[model samples]
Target: MDLDGLDALLAKLDRMDREIEGDVGTIVKNNTIEMTQKVVKNAEFTQGYQTGYTKRNIETKIVSNLVGKTISKSEHSGYLEFGTRFMDAQPFIFPGFYNQKKQFLDDLNRLVK
Candidate 1:
């Protein structure tokens, strides 16, 4: 091809590379957050019974630095899940992650394709 046509082709390829990188990065980040949210929801649902306190307060939040995500609860929430000496540990968060781990991987895999 002539110099002009070759230059045009290179420019397009470079733009496409940049765009694909941006899109893939966004997709991965978003998918990760979504996966965390689903895990948190699973935990909430399986958290035994709910009077709307613990379950309602449960949250999935983005981690800093575009790292990933985290699941959290209100300050008093720790007591309900892990319990103080006066109470028993009900357990919720870890169990939720466990149940949804497979699905999380699946989400990432689909993004690759």
Candidate 2:
């Protein structure tokens, strides 16, 4: 049995693993920022001038190499997203998040393959 071929395969696998480690963080951060931008751009308020408050508060946070988040800092963000008995939901977060999430997963799948 030739052990040389096995060593080459293992070395190639190691290099591929390192490349993936580096790419994962970048992928997460990019997707998170894109999602935040989408949310901010699409977050519409009936009050025209007040729209800046919510858009300005929407931000992206990189938690770690493998994790990231899009946060809405405005006090009324939840109300705007989910709405209440008197108000209909003007959703901005979920649609943006899900769209980016799907692309993120597709990117990961491509990387793995």
Which residue pairs clash in candidate 1?
Answer: none
Which one is best on TM-score?
Answer: 2
Span of 10 residues, lowest total lDDT, candidate 1: 62-71
Per-model lDDT: 0.60, 0.82
How many clashes does each candidate structure show, in the order listed? 0, 0
Q: Compose the digit string of candidate 1's lDDT tens values, residues 41-71.
A: 6546433335555555555454543355545
Off by over 4 Å in 1: 1-51, 64-70
Give the top-scoring candidate (lDDT): 2
After superposing candidate 2, which stretches have Cα over 4 Å from the reference? 1-12, 45-51
TM-score of each: 0.50, 0.82
lDDT tens digits by residue: candidate 2, 1-102 = 656688889999999888899898888888888998888777764232164888888889899998899998888878878888988878888989888889
Please give the lDDT score at residue 80 for candidate 1: 54
